[model samples]
Target: MVRDRLSWMRFCGLGIADTVPDANTLWDFREALIKADALDALFNELDRAINQAGFIPRAGQIVDASLIAAPRQRNSD
Candidate 1:
């Protein structure tokens, strides 16, 4: 989904032509977090912050973003 979703790619700070990490890289990163015993803490803090911000977590929601064409500005040197 991230590969095809502009919103997801933007949220991940990846441009359209950027290379997304494969499953093995993600798994290795997760394993490193697990080894460091930070996964639960990371998620707990994220959940806490989300709830504090009054965001209700939902699943299977499709998010989209649109790009608006803007006029190019010219500056005098």
Candidate 2:
């Protein structure tokens, strides 16, 4: 999935010169966080901030969607 979204990721300043971090890098980062015992703390902080910001959904559904288009192929008669 990340490979397919490389352009969007680069646009967000995640990588440089058409090169994005591979799956190993992401896995290593997650492992380091787990070893440091910070994952729970991180989740707690995110939950607290979201609740404080009044983004809690109430009795309604939330949907996220995106659209991507591909170039048309040339036709040969």
Candidate 3:
């Protein structure tokens, strides 16, 4: 679905000439963040901003628990 969608780059605020990164690029970036121990801090900052914006309900909001499947990788073997 992502491969078929050209709007992701625009949604990410990238210029039309900029290429959207593929799954491997996203994974490597995530790995780098984890290696630097920055992932938790990033999440905390996002959560803090959301809370400050009153997005969290006082009674607690029910979040969708569905899991999104990742794209399959081809085996070289």
Candidate 4:
């Protein structure tokens, strides 16, 4: 799923995976966000590219489950 997002980001002209700033250090992470924010316009432009690519944003399937059942399962089990 992450791969899909990264691929989408690339398609939006944000950049290649390796070309993005290294996020090893706090400074790096901050810088990466700055770069991403600076490219926000480019990302928004993805609406056209995505449409051209035949992608329409729809709600994705629920992959993460809620934790409400966890306590009940533990107690019942």
**Candidate that scores best on TM-score:** 1
Q: Which regions in candidate 4 have their CA more than 4 angstroms from the true location?
A: 1-21, 24-37, 59-77
- Model 2 Cα lDDT, one tens digit per residue, 7-72: 677655765455666889989988999999998999889788889988984546776687778899
Q: In model 2, what is the error at residue 20, expressed in angstroms?
A: 3.4
Question: Total clashing residue pairs per candidate?
Answer: 0, 0, 0, 0
* Whole-model lDDT values for every prediction: 0.92, 0.77, 0.80, 0.62
Query: In terms of TM-score, how similar is model 3 to the real structure?
Result: 0.54
The model with the greater lDDT, 1 or 4, is 1
- Cα TM-score per model: 0.63, 0.49, 0.54, 0.32
lDDT of 4 at 50: 79
Of candidate 3, the 10-residue stretch with the lowest lDDT total is 1-10
User: How high is the lDDT of residue 33 in model 4?
Assistant: 64
Note each model's CA RMSD in angstroms.
12.9, 11.9, 16.3, 9.5
Comparison by TM-score, 3 against 4, better one: 3
- Rank all candidate structures by their lDDT, best first, as comma-separated numbers: 1, 3, 2, 4
